[model samples]
Target: MQRETTGLLSPGTHVVEVDGLSQRYHVYGSGPVCLAVPGGPGVIWESLRTPALEEFLTMVYVEPLGTGGAQRLSSHPHGYTRERYARNLLGLLDALSLPRAYLLGHSHGGFVAQYFALRHPDRLSGLVLFGSAPVTGPEHMAEAGARVQEFVERNEGQPELPRVLAGLQAVGGATDDEQITAALRDLLPAYLAHYWAREHEFKAWRETLTCTYISGLDEDLTPDTVDDRDALPSLGVPTLVVVGRYDVICGPRWAQELNDLIPGSRLVVLENSGHLAHVEEPEQFAAAIRDFVTETSV
Candidate 1:
C-alpha cells in the first residue's frame, strides 16, 4: 500500500497507493503527525505549506486526488465529492499504518475534513477546520457575495479592483486549468486582509499558484452540497476552527457558527488575516495550532 517512503517520519515526498491510485504526501518537521489538506479541491499542495508549524509538527501535506501528480478519476472534474475525498484520507491513513492522526483542512478541504470526522471519528485524534463553513449552496454564495461587496467598498478607488472583480465573475464559468488559475491569481488579493500593501511578499505565491477545474458535481451530475450543522454537535473529536477575520469566502461568521455547533471546539480568529492565516500571520497561526495540540493532546 505504501512505497517510495524510506522512513515513516522521513522528510520529503512519500508515495502511497490507495484504491489503485497513487497518492503522494509530502512530509516535514517532527512531533505529532498532522495531515494538512489544502483547499480549493484543486489547489496545489504547495500553497498550503506552513513552514512555521513544521518546526513543531510533522506536517504531511496531502496531494489530493485530481491535483498535482495524483491520478484523476475517469470522471475527472466531477465525482470529487467529500465522501470520495474522505475515503482517500482513510486510505492514506491506513497506508501509512497510522490508526489515527490530526487533520487540518483548509477551505474546500475543510468541508472534506468535516465529512471525514463525522463518518470516521475513531480515525482522527484532532481536527482543524480552516477557512471552512458548515454548509454550501445558495446561502453560502449569498454570504460570499455580501463579503465581496464589502471588499469592493474597502478598496473602492483601486485601479486593479476591476481585474479582481472580473476574476470573481470568471470563476463560475472557468472550464479549464488555465482559466481557473488566471481567475484565482486575479482574485488572490481579496483572499488577503491587505494584498496591495504586501504584493511584493505574495506575488510569487500568486504567480506559482495553480489549480485544476472541478465542477463541484458528482458523477451523477448532482451537485455535491453540504450541511453539517445538525451533525457537528455529535462529533467527538477535538476540533480547532481557525479563520481569517477578513476572509471573504469563509470568515468569522462561519468559524463562530462552527465553534458553536461543535461542543467544546475551540475557535481562533486571526485578526490580521483573510483566508490564508497561515501565510498572513504565521507565528500566530502556528501558535494557535501548537497550543491547541498541546492542550488537547493531553
Candidate 2:
C-alpha cells in the first residue's frame, strides 16, 4: 500500500476563537453537517481522518484542546474534562452558524458525544458512538484493564505485546518522546481483531499517531464525573452504537450497555474490525452514518 498520498489527510480548516482559546476543525466535503469528535483526549482528530465519511456528509473534525495550536486557556485542573469538550463542540457549531449537526465520536470522543446529546439534545440531528463506553472513570479503566488481562489469556502466543507495553510505564518512555510512541505502537495490535490480517491499517495508523501538547490530556477526559448512564436513554435522539467484534477496550460489554440504555439505538458490530472500525471498514462505517443521517433528517 503506497501511503504517500495525502488526499483526505489534508483538508481546509476554519478556527473559531472562543474565550481567548482557538477551536480548530478540519472541514471536508459538502453536505449535511457532521462533526467528527476524536478520542485520546490529547490525540487530535487528524489520527482518525478518513475521506469516506465526507462523501456522505460535510465532515468537520474538531481538534481536542491543546492540539494544532488550539491551546487551552483554562485555569481549571480538569481543563480536559468531557464537559469542556462538549461545550467546545457546541461553540464550534455556533461559530459556524449551524443550528444542529450530526455528531460522530470514537472511543473517548464517544463520551463527549453522550454529554453533548444530554446537555443539548436540540442541537443534534443524530449521534454515533464507535468503540466507546458508558461507564464512569473507575469502571472505564477497570473494564480496559480487565479486558487486557483477558486478551493476554485468550490469545495464547502473543506474550510479547503486553510485555513491551508494560515497559512504557518506566522513565525511559517518559523522558524520551519517541519511546512513548513506540510503546503505544506495541499496544496497537491489541485493538485489532487479527494483527497480521490487518497489519497494514495498524502500520498506517502508527505512522500517523502523534502525541502533542497536553500529552496527558487523556488523564482527565474520562467520564470522571459525567456518567450519563440514566440520562442517556432520555436524550430522545436517533443513535448508532458501533463496536468491533474484537475491540477489547470498548468491546461487546460497552456496546450492549449503550444499546440497552439508549432507546431506539442501533448497534452494529463490525465483524472484521477492532477498535478502529472506520479504518478497517470505512465504506461500511460511512454508509451507516449516511443511512442514519438520512433516516433521521426528516
Candidate 3:
C-alpha cells in the first residue's frame, strides 16, 4: 500500500473551534469526502487505517472534542450527551467548508453520526455505521460491563495483564491526561492485532493509538438515553449498517435492528470478525462499502 499525505489543508492537525470546544480533524486523499468519526469520546482520528476506503472516498478522520489532538473544554469530569457531539460534528463540517458529504462512524462514533443524521439530515449524503447499535439498552450496557469484568478476570493472573486491565478501567472514568495516555498505550498491541493483519501498514495504524483513547464503557449510550427509533425511517439518505458476527460489543443483532429501522439500508455481517470488522476483514469490508456507495450514488 502506498502512503502519501494529501495536502488538502494545513500540514498538521487543524482545530475547528466550536462553542466551548475545538474539534480536530485530519484531511487526506482527494475525491468525494467522507467524514469518519472515531469510536471514543477520547479516541483519535488515525486509530484505524482504511486503505481500501481511501481508494474511493477522500477520507477525513475526526477526533471528537477533547479527544486526541482536540482541546478540552473543562477539567471537570463530565460525560458528553449525543446532542453535544452532533453539534461538534456540524461545527467541524462548517469549518472544513463541506456542505454535504458522506458520514461514516464507528462504535460510539455511530451514536454521534445517528444524532447528526437526526438533527441535520440536510447536510448528509449518506450514513455508514460500523459495529454500532442504534440504542444500547440497559441490558446491553450491563452485558458490556460483564464483558469488561470477564476480560479482567481472564487476564488477572498474568503479571502485565492486570496493569492493562486497570488502565482500561481508568480510561472509562478518567479525566486526567496522563491516565488516559497510559491506558491507551497499555492496550495498544492487542487492539492492533485484533483488527489488522500483521503487516507494515498495520504498524503505521498501531502508531496512531499512542495518543488515543479507545472507547469508554462508562459513557456508553444505552436505550434509555435514545429518544426515537421512528425517526430513522425518514432519514432519506442511503444508509449502510455493517457488523461483525462475533462482535460481542455491538453484535450482529444490533445491526439487524438498525437495518430494520432505516429504510433502504443494507446490512452486512462478517462471520469471522468481531467488533472491528473493517480491520479484521479489510478487503471484504472495503468491497461492501464501495459497492454500496456506488449503487447509492447512482
Candidate 4:
C-alpha cells in the first residue's frame, strides 16, 4: 500500500513538492480518505487537528503555504488567496495519486474547499464546509461585528471579556507573526461558547496556539475578496455544512445560507459550540463527518 502512492498515505507527516513549493501534510486514522484543510490561511495546522475525526477517517491535515512548515510563495503573504490554496490542494491530491477524496474545510479553509469543489467537482466525493460562509468582505465583516456584539452582551461582566474584545480589535492591524499569534490568543475566548466556564479544559490549547500573518491580498496587494453566492448553487459535489450555534465569525446565518445555496447539502448546528466546533464538541463534529463520508463514499 505504501508503494502504491510513494508513501503519501503511509501515516505520519509527509512533505510533497507542489508547484515548486514544499507542501507539508500530516496523516492519521484509517478509513475513507478525507483531506482536512485547517482554517487559518495563516494559523498553524496543529490548531485544527481533530483527533476524534481521526478515529473514523484517514485525516490528511494540510499545512497550507505561507504557514507552519509549508514553503511560502514568492509573494509571501499576499498571494495566499483561496484560489491559490485550492490549487495547492489539487497538487496535493494529485501527488497522493487520489482520483477523489472527501474534503473538510474549517473556517477560512471552508472557503478554499467550496471554491475547489466548484472549480474541480470531478475530484471530490464529498465536501464539508465547517464554520464557513458564502461571502466575505464588508457584508461578512458587518455580520461578524454584530455577532461579536452579541458575544459581548452574553458575557458582559466577565473579566476576561475585555481582553478578548481587545484581541478582536487588534486582529485587523496585526502585520507580523508575533502580532497575529497574540491577537488570535486574545480573541480565542470569544470564539468559544463559554470560555470562562471551562477554562481548565482549554487553557493549555490557547496558551500553545500559534499563527502566521497572511495579508488577505493578492500578489499585487489587492484584496482577494470572496462572494460565492451565485456559484454555490451550481456546485454538484455532495456537501455538509456544519456550524456552531455560538460561532461569532461565521455563525448560523452563514451556514444556513450555505445550506440553502448548495443543492442537497446537509446542515448540522452544534448547539453548544462556538467557532471551533471540532474542539468544543468533538464527538458531534466527528459523528457528522463520519456519517457524511459513509453515505457519500462510493
TM-score of each: 0.98, 0.85, 0.77, 0.98
Question: Quick one: ranking by lDDT, best first?
Answer: 1, 4, 2, 3
Candidate 4 per-residue lDDT, tens place, 1-298, comes to 1325647887899988888888889999888889989887688999889899888888899999999768899888799988899999999899899999999999999999999999999999999999999999999999999999999999989988889999999989999999999999999988999888999999999999999999999999998788999999999999999999999999999999999999999999999999999999999999998888888874
lDDT of 3: 0.69
In model 2, the Cα lDDT at residue 262 comes to: 94
- In terms of lDDT, the best-performing candidate is 1
Encode model 1's per-residue lDDT on 1-298: one tens digit a residue.
3333337558998777889887888999988899999998799999999999999888999989999788899999899999989999998888877888999999999999999999999999899999999999899999999999999999999999999999999999999888999999999999999999998999998999999888889999999998999999999999999999999999888999999999899999999999999999999999999999999789
- Model 2 TM-score on a 0 to 1 scale: 0.85
User: After superposing candidate 3, which stretches have Cα over 4 Å from the reference?
Assistant: 1-12, 145-175, 181-224, 227-230
Question: In candidate 2, which residue ranges exceed 4 Å CA deviation?
Answer: 1-11, 74-78, 167-182, 213-223
Better of 2 and 4 by TM-score: 4
Which tens-of-lDDT digit does each residue in 1-298 have in candidate 2? Answer: 2122133223586666755577777888777888888875556577678799878688888887765456664543235777678878887777777778899898878988998898888998999998888875678667877776766666667656655347434312343345545555666667777775656646777666764333333344432554678887787878999898878778889999999999999999888787888887888877877888888987
